[model samples]
Target: MTTENKGIVQRALAGLIETGDVNTLASFLSDDFLHHRSDATTSTKAEWLAAVHAALGPTAGMQVEILHLLADTDHVVVHSRRRLPDAGPEIVVVDVLRVADGLIAEVWEIIEPVAQTAVNAAWWEPARL
Candidate 1:
């Protein structure tokens, strides 16, 4: 059952990013869900939905890649990747989630910027110090 929940949770998150469908996402979330962002800010379910709407702007093109998944009872952890409309690709995003009463009740994430050595090594003149 936990495995099924994990799959459901992951799919819901993916759908949220893909379609910017707040309603669909909300159905799977607890009202008091605790969300810990990769940037370290915590928010409730309402806040998260608002943030997604703001980020979507007039065009929605965000994409999510689920690299791996692990489930332990009501807890689900995922290593994932996301691509934003105007942002470069990043890697190593870890999301920890808790599901209760058939809804996602808590979530935490850690994200890291992808090291772009090629871009970094490009010849771009730095400002005079």
Candidate 2:
């Protein structure tokens, strides 16, 4: 079940990135899905899908690279980097998804913009021995 949950999320994310099809992405989500953002705001399935469509509909060159994926029981965690069409700084995102009955029921996401100048190394960078 853990593998299945991971596969479901991977496929959903792949579908969104590859085709930018909100409808296809919607198929993987439950009707009562809720999205919890890092801003302390939450969105329902409809609102979330609408935002996704608005964001992806115009960004044909947007890219998302998955950095790591881990699954335990019904939860799947994904760490990824997104480069939007605006050519701005890349954003690092970590999404935790709860899969229920083969569909994504809830999602919690944290986003951070990459800094051009930083005092320390990026958290995602490989550490030197």
Best candidate according to lDDT: 2
Candidate with the greatest TM-score versus the true structure: 2
In candidate 2, stretches whose alpha carbon ends up further than 4 angstroms from where it belongs are 58-60, 116-129
TM per candidate comes to 0.74, 0.85
Which residues of candidate 1, in runs, are more than 4 Å off?
A: 38-40, 56-58, 87-91, 116-129
Worst 10 residues of 1 by lDDT: 120-129
Q: Write the per-residue lDDT of candidate 1 for residues 2-106, one digit (tens) a residue.
A: 888788787777777667777788888888988898677999888877876665433666566778888988899988776766675655578888988888999
Write model 2 residue lDDT over 87-107, tens digit each, in one string. 767888899999999999999
Name the weakest run of 10 consecutive residues (lDDT summed) in model 2. Answer: 115-124
> Candidate 1 at 108: error in angstroms?
0.5
lDDT of each: 0.77, 0.88
